[model samples]
Structures are given as C-alpha cells and as structure tokens.
Target: MSLIYEARSSSSLLVAGVARGLTTQGGRLVRPAENCWHMVVVRQGGEASMRLVGPWTGAGVASYGEGAEILWIRFRLGTFMPGQPVTGLRDQETLLPAATGHSVWLNDAAWPLPGIDDVDAFVERLRRAGVLTHDPLVQDLLHEPGSGLAPRTERHRLLRATGLPLRHIRQVERAQQAAALLGQGVPIPETMFRLGYFDQPHLTRALRRWVGHTPGQLLRAGEEHLPLRTRPLDAPSLH
Candidate 1:
C-alpha cells in the first residue's frame, strides 16, 4: 500500500477534520462506519471532480486510482444542507456536476472546488450562503439523551439532521473506541471489559460490523489498512 495519508484537526464549527492524501499506486482501504457525512474532491490526470458521500451505515472497501490526489472534508454531525435532506443520501453518494475545471454546481450555483489549504474558507462561504447549517436540537439530543423534547420529536430531528438513528451512532462510537484500544496493544478481554462489551464474541461482532476488522486483525494488520480516528478537531495545536 503506497498510500500517504495525513489528517488534521479543523477549527471550523461545521467540520470535524480534513484529510489530504495521495494514492501512489491504486489500492483499496477499509472504510469504517461513520455517523458524520463527508465531501471528497479528487484530482487526477489534470481533471478535478467532487462528490458528497453520506454517512456510512457499515464498514466497506474504498478504492483509489494510482497517483490520485484526495482531499476529504468530514462534517460534524448535525450539520446539513437546507433543502437537500441527508436522509436520501444515506449509504450513497451524489456526484456534483462540474461547472468548470475549477468549480462545481451546488444548489444551482457555481461553487468553487476547494483545495486543502482553503477548505475552511469554502465551508465558511457555504455557511454564509445558508447552504450549510447545524441543528442544535440534534446536538442537544446527542449530548443528553434525556432531552426535554418528546421521544418522537427527538427521533425525527435526529434522523432528519444526520440520517442516522441514535442507537446506530452509539454503536459506531463504541466500536471505534474498541478499535483504538485494541490498536494500542490492549488485550481483547481488557478492551471488552473497559468498553462494557458482554464478552470477546460481542466485541468481535461489533468491530467486524463497524470497523471492518476483527480484534485480532487490528493487531496484526498494518496501520495503512486500519480505518482509524484522527486527532480531535478542537485540539489547540491545530489552530
């Protein structure tokens, strides 16, 4: 795997992180299940294109072309487009039509494709245009389950904003925690106990479903194949 991947924390409220990489030789990677949505820009053969990838429900394989340059913008949960409900994009992708070599069509407007250095500014423009927004209701529910809102309303708001059930997000988060622990040389039983899993089998199942790797595989596999978490987006060093 000749993949050179480097991700950094973002200071933007609407973004979780930004990753820029080069796939020197075409290869596949294990993409873990995620609650947050993403926008990916690819530049190869002197052609640029963009795509909106919805929140993934499970682990899968992602392929890249040789010498492909990639910039991935991961949006924080609860951030969404106004008219384009994320519900319809779950587990799928929408390819943004190219307006020019350097821009794409979004909301019937010509939006410039963002380079890695200018992504924060691009996101700010989206916010100013009312094209991207964050839902406080969803954030509140995620932070505190015992919200004042009715159960039905909470579910509706969560689904509408993130296109994912609360339970699904929790499961994915737990699985990620487990993967992090296991990758750091923690024992399986200890990881299970620390994370409140029932047993080894339970931990194994969760990892396989959400992380695409069993506990054993995570320990044995190289870091290149692991779908791992980057640094927190609010880390002071990032700013």
Candidate 2:
C-alpha cells in the first residue's frame, strides 16, 4: 500500500509547519533537504518513539515500517532546544528516551507525546520551560545582515542555532523556491532568471542536490516530489 501524507500551517512563530504520514505497508520515500529541523514522533507496533531530526543538506531516502504513523513538528530556522544544541544535530538525529508510555524524556523532564491537535500547546509549554528558544539575531542577520555583531561572533551564533553556515541555508532556500516555481509550470529559463541562478545547469544542479529532481523531473513530478512542504514561489523572503 502507498503511504498517505498531510501537512498544515502553524500559527506559532517557532514553528515552520506540521506534517503527518501513515504507512499501511513498509516503503521508502524520497526525503528532500530541509531548511529547518523537526521533532518527530513515530508509532509502530503499539510502541511510540520521539526523535529530534536535524536539517538535511542533500536528498535522502527514508524507510518506513508497515503500519507506521508519523508526526513531524518542523521548527523554524534558529529555534532550538536548550542544551540539545542544534550544532551537533546536523544530518543526524537524537532519539529521546521514553519516560512512560505517553511521554518521553527531554531536558531532564517528561514531555508528553503530543497528538496532532496538541502541537501548539506543547510548543508553548516547551518555551515556558526554557527548553525551546529562538535566536532573533540569527534570523535577523539572514534577512539583511545588520546585527551589529562582530563577524566571528555572528558566524558562531549562526552555526550554533541552525547547524549550517549562512551560505548553505540560503542555497537550500533558493533551490526550494526554484523547485516550487518549476512545479507550478513556470518555464526553466524563467525560473533561472527569477531566482538569480547563473544558468539552466546551475539551477538543475542545485535542484538535483537539494530537491532530488531536475527541472524537467520536478515539472513532471508535481505534488508527488518530496515528503516535505513545497514553499510558495511568491514568498517575500525568497526575493
């Protein structure tokens, strides 16, 4: 059987989005590189597990078990858990220990496994408890680079908060924009010019590395391209 997936936008500033997937039979899916990280909960065979997934820089394949249900809380860039530094989480995951059937150990306490409807409240609790935070400077610097901090300090803070350098994050974001445009039937030359890619091959290579599909493939793939959210081409930040 094929896996079913759904996603919804979140109102919380700390959250980028939320998504859930279910698999009746085991299968592999193409997971695209992401600009932000996520906290994922998986249920299989009557057991539940919570894991912190980090930002990915390249395309990868993820395997799901038969009869698996997964929920992902995709956090915004620069939001991270205190003590569970995002730096060490790049391209990897940290599986939290189960404190009980309904909760897991995080930041020295039990955090209940949240259902789909409870995500916002759960994140609010983490923020109140000092387990979740956002680095405003890092996010601000990315937009226009006028934080007033020394170059070295800014670099350190960026790496610590997002687990990738400024350039990589921008590149990933750009590639995602390109993919979204191509998927929406925009011509290749138009996409290249709109997003500031040097040429068609430059756009193609970036898409292949980050989106796991070439321009033509993305046009053909449509909404079935990746498991993550496809950003809007007109999003103000992309320009």
Candidate 3:
C-alpha cells in the first residue's frame, strides 16, 4: 500500500493545516491520540462523504477501500465551527449532508469543498459567511505561554475554545511525543525517562491507549526503518 500526504499552506488563524492524501491499496488506518478536530472528505470511486471528527482521547481505527482520496482540514486545538460546539462531538464522528457540486452542509448552509490549492480561499469564504470563528483568548494563551491570567479564568477560556481540559491535551501531546521517540529507535525505558512517565508499565499503558502499540512492538517495526516519519499506531504487536 502507498500513501501520499502534503501539508497545505493556510493563513486562517483557526486552521492548523489542510492535509491532503491518497491511499492506494487501503486497509485499516489507526488514528492516535489528538486534541484537535478534523473536517474530513473521503472519496472512493464516484462516491464522496464529508464528516467532522472531534478530539480523540484514545486510539481508534478506520478502514477505507483501495484508491481512496482523502482531504482534511485540521483545525487548531482551540477552534471549531461556529454554532457547533466541539464538546458535543468529542470522540465522535458526525457526517455532513452532501450538497451539489461536491459541497457539504454546515449549519444548514452549503459549503463548497475546495481543491487542495484553494484551501485558503475556502477559509476566507467561511470567514466572510460568518461560519468560522475562534476565541481570541485561545491564541493569547497559546502564544503567550507566560500569561498571568488567573488559573480559574484560564481554565474557563481553554474549555470554551478547545472543548477539553488542559490535562487531557497534555496527555495526548505526551503520548504522541512518545510514539515519535519510539519510531526513532529510542528504548522504552529511556523514552519513559525523557517523557516523565512513571515507569515502563505506565508508558506501556499510555501507548496502548493513545498510540495503540506496545513499546516492544514499535521497536521491532522500527527495525525495518520505513520512510514514513510517523509510525502507524495500528501496527501489530510483537506479543
């Protein structure tokens, strides 16, 4: 199986990236822990579907047929569709009704799906239509890490913008970081130390829950040294 991925450039502050990919010989795709939401469009043969994926706190699996073309806009941690709170969609996938000309319904209005090259333009259109908006405090808290906002106030702002607690976000980030380190051939014990895990078992539990792999399995797969920088969390276990 082969897959090609590209990160599209975007100017919208709410969008993290517009990622486009094509999978030939598709099978199962494992989505690891993450804090952001994804607006995904998948096309197989002549049929296409659009959906919104909310923050995933644990590992999950998805399957696609061969020759599937997928395009997704991954929103930044603290952004969501206006009038649709992400908290309601946490750990869930909500399908959007398809409209004419490859468009989809968002808030009962038709939203045209732009080509990979037109992501910035599409975002601009959403902004003009008042369908995309974000809380300014999220940017402030993210960029100004040292902001002295009161703890209670900061927590409220974070919940409003990201639909998740700070602790959950940290857990997801740490789990992803651990996966990257393992893919680089780091030993589990060392990775645990580096990431401040309590012990090997602690690391193992986090990986199993968030990355869907045990350390030993990840290490064995790393021996093949695949070109893909990111390891597939769905990789089979050695045990």
Candidate 4:
C-alpha cells in the first residue's frame, strides 16, 4: 500500500491519473468497483507486462508481488481509445501488445508510454492522432447533474460515451458512495436512508453487486483495520 508517486492529468477533457507504487508484502487486495478503465504496467524479475483493466461491476481481488514496481494509468469515465471500444472491454481484462519496454501498439501505431510527468503530453498526442476522444454530451451529463435532453437521446448519448447504461452507472456510483460512508463509520440505517435505498435488502443488493461486500462485511473490515483499496481515482487527495 505504499505509493511512490501519483498525479492527475492537467487536461480538462481527460479526467485521469497515474500512480506508481510498490507492495511491501504480496497478497490478495480488494480492488473495489471503479468507473474508469485502468492501463497497468508491472515489472518483476526483469520482466514487464501491460494489461488493460476494464470498468468493473463488482469488487475483485488482485495479487501483487512484494517489492514489485507497479505503474498504472486510469482513464476518465467517458474517454477511450478509438480501436479499443469501452463496450468490448467491460468487466474484462485484456493484455495489450507491447512493442518495447516503454511502448505499446495502439491504433495501428507504436505508442510510447509516457512517464508520470508526461501524461498530459501523451494525452495530447492521443488527441492529435485521433486515438483519444469523448462525447461532449457525456461530459456534460456527468458534470451537470441533469440534462434537458429527451430520455432516449440521453440514453443513447451515455451509451455511446461510456458503453454502459445509465442505470448501471447509477448503481455503481451509489454503491461506491455507500461504501465510502460506511468506511467513515456511518450507521447502516442512516446510510440506507441517506442513499435513497428502499430498505436494508435494497441496500444489500447494490453493495453485493457493485461493492462485492455486504454492509456488515464492510463495517467489520473497517473495524478490524483491514486494508481496502476503494478510493476513487478522482479523489483530490492521495495517500
């Protein structure tokens, strides 16, 4: 859980971040549900592999190696590479073909992986090369709270941008919010009411699907001081 460096993209259209870290001990860690896709590069024993982690609907466990160097780039919700559509990657992990230690083949070209400090520049290159793009309507819909478009139009736009239905997005968002509140020691009844769940069962279903943990499990983990990596990439602060 030790992070060596972390940074976010400077571009407004690309709400993403990069983190590099090393694990002190090797074991399974809970990777909570996330809205964005992750491009991870790991190096161990003089070997490296690049993998793409799609938006996950449920929490999962991932294994890391002790003292391994891990670097990852998490893309924004509505942003994606042209050839690699977000829809195809949903709830799956795909290994990217590598051209070199610091480069991968993307969009029929060799894309040199940028270091933490050069993420913005790399995004700029993607923009110029037509590799990175997002729907303006999707951006507006996510940031504006509400949109005036017709229901059908809004659904279509969201699907085109995020490759998932609005209901799915709301479920993940609510589940994450609930997990955050629970981690903060909020009472279960209060959390249910505040999150607009119909009842305890309703809340439990959402948490089980999106959070991969029940309310009691989350609470116990918090009380027992278990390490859970549920922090959203867009959080203003990093640890």
Off by over 4 Å in 2: 226-239
Order the candidate numbers by lDDT, best to worst.
1, 2, 3, 4
Q: What's the number of clashes in each of the models?
A: 0, 0, 0, 0
lDDT of each: 0.85, 0.84, 0.76, 0.74
Model 1, residue 211: distance off in Å is: 0.5
What digit string (tens of lDDT, one per residue) describes model 3 on residues 19-92? Answer: 76667566676667778888888877787788888788788876666777778888887776668787877899
**Residue-wise lDDT of candidate 4 within 1-239, one digit each (tens)?**
43333444455366477776656567776667787887777776776777778787677877776667677788777887777778777789888788887688877898876655676777788888998887777767766766898878988777766778877777899998998888788989999999999999999988877777888887767533344233444554432
> What TM-score goes with each of the models?
0.92, 0.91, 0.83, 0.82
Of 2 and 3, which scores higher on TM-score?
2
On lDDT, the candidate that comes out on top is 1
Candidate 4 C-alpha error for residue 81, in Å? 1.8
Give one digit per residue, the lDDT tens place, for model 1 in 1-239: 35666687777899999987777678677788988999999998899999999799999988888878889999999999987888877898889999999899998899989987799999999999999999888778777856887899889888988999899999999999999888887888899989999988999999999999999987666353443334433433321
- Model 2: number of backbone collisions: 0
RMSD of each: 3.8, 5.7, 6.1, 4.3
lDDT, candidate 3, at 58: 86
Clashes of 3: 0
Instruction: Rank candidates, TM-score, best first.
Output: 1, 2, 3, 4
The CA-based lDDT of model 3 is what? 0.76
| Model 1 ranges with Cα > 4 A deviation | 222-239
